[model samples]
Target: MSNFINKLWGSKSKASKTVTFGDSSFVNAPGGRIWTFISIATLILLWVLSSIFEWVKPIYWPPIQDVWSQFLVISSEGFRNSTLLEHVAASVGRVLAGFLLGCLIGIPLGFALALSKTMNRIFDPIVEFLRPMPPLALIPLVILWLGIGESAKIFLLFLASVWILALAARSGAMSTNLSKVHAAYTLNASKRQILFHVILPNALPEIFTGMRVAIGVCWGTVVAAELVAAESGLGMMVMVASKFLSTDIVVLGVILISLIAYVIDIFMRYLERRFVPWRGKAKH
Candidate 1:
């Protein structure tokens, strides 16, 4: 038993090599960085040129300058009785609230499912059933039950994220190596220590992956819900602007949402790296 534990720890220490992106290596390469810049610049150049040359009507595709001017106006003069920042804040708040709540409930439920056969047998069917249903399709029912208040919107966002997170957690926990658990046992580690140190750590990477995906879904769900009925939000801004054919405001709202989502994903990646630096390093 002592020899086996030593062998396990030695192997783990030797396997401390960092993971690399392989095919996606260019993402961090200097040449790849240049290409990214060029790609974005080309699109911006085309947008500007299109406006100057009138390639597409302003109604269909507004000039970048027009969009910027509208942004300044909305930033100061306000849009639909609320400033641009307020709308953004409203949307972001709903997403964070619902997503955090989903994580709190879903992660434990997932761990329970992975650890207990009874929990799996009971909840697996319900999770699978709900997974296929579209969050948008639930709007009518959500409104019926929760009404068109903030609760309704938050509940919709919650539904969008919870199932995905639950599954991610279960997969992560189930994927923990039995050999590692046995090694812990051989070292006289208690079950609680093994669960916390071995199983939970092993499960973190999948949970982070699920979080990235769930956040994106929550953003989409909240926006769609706001479009249905909300006094404030980026989606509401877009919907209200469309009613008056205020294309620039609509474009601005979309750009803001996309930019925020991108930033959030970057943040999630940073957290994943910070918490699970050993992820992908362990040899099977």
Candidate 2:
């Protein structure tokens, strides 16, 4: 037993050496960075060339410079009377409220369904029935029930986000390897210990992925919700801009949404990395 323990604990002299700094790894690390920059540079060049030759009309595809100036104008005073920040704040607030509500309900319900067969049997049918209905399809009902106020917007965003998150949680819980659970049992871990220390940690990566996807869906749905009943939001800005044929404002609105979604995705990814250090570095 001592010999076996020593062999397991001792480091072998023939073990592979770790790579040091100033090696080939550094060269490989920068390849992805260079490729990303190149892609952006190529797109900018194409945009400039297209604008110079009038390859597309300004109405349909405005020049980059015009879009930049229009973005500044919108940022300063905005379309109609509302400023860009006000529109952004309103949209973000709605999404946050709805997303928080969905998370509060979805995460616990997901765990319940994943853990308890009885609970799963009870809720699965209802979830399946409602999951197929698009949030936009429920706009009229939501307005009628919630009175075309913030409640309607929140409900729509919640509807958009909850199903995706619930499905993700269910899948993650189901995918946890049985062997790990068995090992936990062999070690005499309690149900709570198995859940918190084993299942939840393993499920976190999938949960974050779901949240990233949910954020994108929420952004898209919030715009739609705002388009229907909002007085001031990025979606409302685009709708109003369309009536006046202010393509620049519309473009700015689209860009702003993209930026916000991108930022949220980045934050979620950072959280994933922080919590799931075993996941290693992300590719991009």
The model with the greatest TM-score is 1
Question: What residue pairs clash in candidate 2, if any at all?
Answer: none
Off by over 4 Å in 2: 1-31, 186-188, 280-284
In angstroms, the error of model 2 at 110 is 1.8
- Quick one: best lDDT, which candidate? 1
Please write out the lDDT profile of model 2 over residues 1-284, one tens digit for every residue: 76554444443347545764645434323223545667889988998998899899888977888889987887897666777888899999999888888877777777777889999999999888988899998898888888878889989999998988888888778777888899999999999999998888777777777888888899998878886668889888888777888787778788899999889877887787678876534352
Q: Kindly list the per-residue Cα lDDT of model 1 for residues 1-284, writing each as its tens digit.
A: 76555543332345444764455533422322445567889999999999889898878878888899999998998887889889899999999988998999899889988988999999889888998899989999999999889999988888899998999999999999899999999998998998899988999999999999999998777768796589899989888888888888888888999899999998998898789987776778
Q: Can you give the lDDT of residue 191 in candidate 1?
A: 84
Clashes of each: 0, 0
Off by over 4 Å in 1: 1-22, 25-31
Enumerate residue pairs that collide in model 1: none
Q: What is the C-alpha RMSD of each candidate to the true structure, in Å?
A: 9.3, 9.7
